[model samples]
Target: MRTIDECRAEVFRRSEEKIKARRRARVRAAALCVPLCLCAVIMSVAFMLPKGPRTEEDMMQEDGEAPGGASGTEFSNDLVGDGRDDDVNAPGGEGSLSVSFSLTWGTYGISSYDSATGRLVKATDATRPEDYVTTYRLTDEETELISELIRGLDIDRYPDVYDPQAGKLGSDPSMTLILSVRMGAKEKTVTAKNIALTYESEDPDGQLFLDVCREIVEILTGTEAWQSLPEYEFFYE
Candidate 1:
C-alpha cells in the first residue's frame, strides 16, 4: 500500500544498513588481526637476533679456537703453582728437581715437571704454548725416575748447541729438540737441531738426547690427562 517514493526510501535504508554492517565486520576483523600481526613480527625479530656469548663447553664442542688464540678452556697459572717453594732451592730437598722438554718444527709441544708439588704440565699444538695446557701429578717413584734419567744425561757436559757439520751429507734436519733441567743450584739447557738425523747417524750425544726425549715422551703420553686432550691436528714431516 506504500507509495513508490516510500518503497524506494525503504530500499535505500536497507542498503545503507547492509553497508554499515559490512564496515563493522571489517573493523572487528582488523582489530583481531592487528594483535596477531604484532605478535608474529615480534617473534620473527627475536629469532633473527644474534645469541649471547658461547659457553666453554659449546666452544670446545665446535673444536674452535677461543678468543686471544687460546683454547676454549681457560688457562690458569695457579694450576702449576708458584715457584716460591723453599724446597726447590734446597740441595737434596724433595723439591729441588725441575725438568722441561720441548720439540719444535711444523708443530710445537712442551712438557714441564716440577718436583716441589709433583706437578707435571704438558701442552701440545703449542702454536701458543701458554694457551692450551693440561696438568697432572707424578707419583714419588715416577719423580725419582725422572730425576735419575736427567742426572744420567750428564747434560752439563753437552754443548749448548748441536748443529750438523756443513759438509755432513744426509743431515737435513727438519726439527729441533730443547731440554732444560734444574737441580738445586745447577741448571743446563741443550738445543739440538736435526737431532733425529744425528741419532740415526749413531752420534753418541744425539743418541743420548733422543733416548732422554723418548723417555719423557713415554711418561707424558702414558698419563690419563694427556689421553684426554684433543688429538694433534698438525705434525712435523
Candidate 2:
C-alpha cells in the first residue's frame, strides 16, 4: 500500500531536518568559541604591557592620604626629631668648652653644653623656639671625666675626621660631633662625621671616637635628668 511519490517526499523532509539540526549545532559552537577567543586575546594584551616606576602620588594614594600627611616630609622630620636650635648661653664669653651633635638620619637632636657653669641646653627645631629647655649641672667628677675622655679620643688632633664611608649614598653616619674649646685668646672647633665605630676595623684606635661620644651623652643626661623629663627622647628633632 506504499506509493513511490509519497515515499520520495518523506525522504526529502527528513534530509531537510538533518540539515537544519547541523546548522543549529554549528551556530552554538561559533557562539561559544567567540567569547573564549576574546578572553584569551585580552589576557595576552594585559601580559604584554610594561610596568613603570611608582610615583609619589601612587605611594600617597596607597597610604590613604595626600602628601605631607605622614609619609611625606612631615613624617621624615618626626623620625629625625626636633633638637638642633640656636645656643641658649649665659653670655658670649661664658662658655669655656661646648659640645653639640646632629645626625644625617634617625633620632634628631642638637644640644650644647658649657663646662664652665655645668649648664646643658638643647633644642630640636630651629623654626620654633623651645618652650622649656631641659637643663642639668654636670658634677665635678663628670666634668673631669669628660676632659680626660676628650683628650683620649684625640678629637683635637683630627679637626675634620671622616670615616672611610663618608659622602657615600648609603653611608651610615652615627652623628656629627661639634666640639669647641675656648682657652685664653685662642678658640678652636672640631667637627667629626661618621664617628661611630660600628664595624670592625684594622685600626683598634678607631673606636675611641664613638666611645667618647657615647660617654658624653650618658654623663650629660643621666637617669636623674631623664626621670625629671620622661619625654627626653622626643626632644631631639
Candidate 3:
C-alpha cells in the first residue's frame, strides 16, 4: 500500500519534521525576546538620569537664598510679610547700629552704634566673660533709650529666621541673638534663639522673642564692661 520509493521517502520524512519544528520555534522566540529587550533597555536608561543633591528646598527654589545667607531667611517681602518698616521709621539719624551675642558656654557679645561716632559700644567677651572693653557717650537720655529699644522690636514678626532646632535645650548651654540696623543703604538683621527650653514654651510669639531677648540682655549686661567683670555672669539663665 506504500511504495513509490516509499512514497518519496514519506515525503522526505514529513519535510524533515517540518524543518525541525521551525527551528525549534525560532529558538524559543529568541530566548524569549532577549530578556524582554534587555528589560526595556534598562528602563530607558533609568529614566534618562540626573538627580541627586541640592535640597534646603532646592536652595529655596534655586536662588531665593535662605538657609543662612544674610543670617538666613533672607528678608524683604516688605520686610517679612508686610509687617511694615516704612524705611525703618524714617527720621534724621542716618544709619548704623549693631548687636550680637553668641553662646554655648563661651559667650561673645557686642553692641555698637554710629551716628558718626555719637558713641555707644559695649563689647563683652567670654570663657566666662573674662575679657572686656567699654565705651559710652551719646546722652540724649541714652540716645532716646537706644532708639526706643531698637524701634520696639517686633522683628518682622519673627516666623523662624534659622531655627536650627528652635532654641534647643539641655546641651549644657546655648544662646544666640543678633540684631542689626543700617538705615541709609538699607540693612536689617535679626536672629534669636535663647534655648532655655525656648522659654519654657507657650509660644505667645515665642514669648515675645524671649521678652525682647531679656531686654537686650539687660542692655548688654548693663555695661561698664559688664560692671568690670564681677565674676562675669548672665549664663543665659
Error of 3 at 186 (Å): 3.9
Window of ten residues with lowest summed lDDT in model 3: 96-105
CA displacement after TM-score superposition, residue 161 of candidate 1 (Å): 1.1
Q: What are the Cα lDDT values of the candidates?
A: 0.50, 0.45, 0.44
**Candidate 2's residue-wise lDDT over 1-237, tens digit each?**
679998999899999998897566444434543453354445445544447888888777768755445543221111111111123222432321233222121123255555654444544444443632455655546544554454344333444545523433223434455555443333455555553434223433343444455556656666375345434444322
Best-to-worst order by lDDT is 1, 2, 3
Model 3 agreement with the true structure over 85-190: per-residue lDDT tens digits: 3333334343223221221112233434343343444445444422433444443444444444443443444543534245444233555555554443444566
**Total residue pair clashes for candidate 3:** 0
Point to the candidate with the largest TM-score.
1
Two-way TM-score contest, 1 vs 3, winner: 1
TM-scores of all candidate predictions against the true structure: 0.46, 0.42, 0.22
Deviation in Å, model 2, residue 41 alpha carbon:
86
* Model 1, global lDDT: 0.50
Q: Indicate the worst ten consecutive residues by lDDT in candidate 2.
A: 76-85
The parts of candidate 1 lying over 4 Å away from their true place are 1-131, 163-173, 197-199
